[model samples]
Target: MSTPQEEQARRNAAVLQAIGAQQPAQPEWPAQPQPPQEGDLWVPPLGPAAIDPTATAEEGAGKLSLAFWVLPDAVFGMILALALQVIALFGFMAAQGLKTQEDIQSLQFDPTFTLIAAPTLGIGFATMAVMRIRLLRKLPWSWFGLHLRTIGPALGWGTVAGFAFLAINFASGLIFERLGSTPDQAEQIIGPFRSASSLQLGLLGLFIVVVGPFLEELFFRGYVLRAIRQRLGATWGIVLSGALFAAPHALSITTGFIGLLAPIFIGGLILGYVYQRTGNLWSCVLAHSINNLVGFLGLLAALSLP
Candidate 1:
């Protein structure tokens, strides 16, 4: 209804009012404050997990980097010592002329049992000594799990297997007697076969129960079996070690023939299997002890029979 100029002035004023309403009075910023460079913002670069580079597979189970730990070195050292022991045994046997029946019987006076024990113990000591060397060098004996838990099973199974071995021997002896075949005497067989006084028997039993098992387990199952397993496959390791185990019995003149060899071979197989399964020496030791005990007990029973 107003004049044209008045109408134009009103429209312009309304446009100005709308523009003023849309324009912000001051700039708004993000709600979060910027992180401090020294505190929260500094993220260091991450590399691979901390592990030694020289370790074997057995040494680096869950490690990020493969590294040589102390255990493998110690174990290798033990193998070296055992190899040396075998050579020494061969040398000594050759020197003593322990080939024929007379030579073997004569040498029994200076028992291989006593001599072999020294080298076996030395191997164990040397392995532990090598581990100490690693420790001094500030290397990883840290990762080695000295599992005492495996002892129980080792002892239990070793005893059982040992008893089984004795049973086999007794049965074999009976079969030989029935067939009118003279049994060849093996060292272990003779060692237990010869009956001294009751005191002597008791002492021998003690040795069988304790020392024999410990020594055999250490040398055969613990060191020999484990080392061979590392090189050969486990089956080969068990078989070869078992054969080697029977070699000591070759000293027996009367009973060391093919007949006795069968049982010894079979016994070795059982023992080697036990050692492989347990990963502990105690089981083999216990099994060996129990086997000897069974033999001793059986002998006494036979002697006492009316």
Candidate 2:
């Protein structure tokens, strides 16, 4: 008789065979590999899984490059500015029956069109820039330095900074005037607004105190400055971005009054520094708005004087 161990082994083999008979037969072709399930450690094929050295750094880092940020900003900004100017021109023509180039030129100073056009341009450009940043970079709005937590402090600081900047500007202007230079072209540009109807003046005031500052801060301090800071170091970034911010306004600088560039550049630096420190776009916006408000109030006071 077989030993107990031998019998047990035979019985186990038979039982396994019986169970195997109940199962389906194996396929002729090599069995297809099973898909990896949870808890599986899958190793991709060596060649196919290799990382590409040529892949874009920005894509790898999941952020836009400086070029991507600036190009769309400039192109869309110019387009929007041009489009708004054209629309304003058409609106002015419809209202005033303007036909000749001279008529349009003369009416360019109309407060209603000027006030409406300026804010519309700024808002449109800012909206485009924000949208580009969102869609292309897939970034959150807060990436543009918009935050509510610091808004109150930002506004308070902004107010103080605005007043200080105004004081400096005033002192500089007085010194320049004493040096036998004529008034800045900005004065000429603003002179007509002083004579605008109360309604136009009110609209202009709203634009200056609210829309203008918000849009400018969003574009300059929020978008441009942030992109620059990401690429260059903070110091050069702030300086370059501030210089860019001052460029367009430089066009308004009078021939003999190049000193005006200093104030605009200085203002840009202050706004940029505030944005950099607080990481709050609204802080800069509020500061700029307060500055504009002060100027607006001063204009009104001057106009009211006999």
Q: What does each candidate score in C-alpha RMSD?
A: 14.4, 13.2
Q: Over 4 Å off in model 1, which ranges?
A: 1-147, 174-182, 186-195, 301-306
The sequence of per-residue lDDT tens digits that candidate 2 reaches over residues 1-306 is 999999998888789898875445676998777886998745444321222111222222344465356656756786888888788889878887989898877765667767766666576658776776676566677777777977878777777778777876787677767776644565655756757888888887888788788887788877777776656545665787778676666545465444676676788888888877777788788888878888788778877766
Best by TM-score: 2
Over 1-306, each residue of candidate 1 has an lDDT whose tens digit, in order, gives 799999998888789898875533587777865554764433223321112121233322333221223235445655766777667666777876667677545544443433443345445534553343343333333222125776666567767777778777777777766766544453444453354456655655666567656655555555455545544457876887687667655544555266666677788888888766766666666667777677667656764555
* Cα lDDT for residue 225, candidate 2: 75
Off by over 4 Å in 2: 1-64, 180-186, 253-257
Best prediction by lDDT: 2
**Model 1: lowest-lDDT 10 consecutive positions:** 46-55
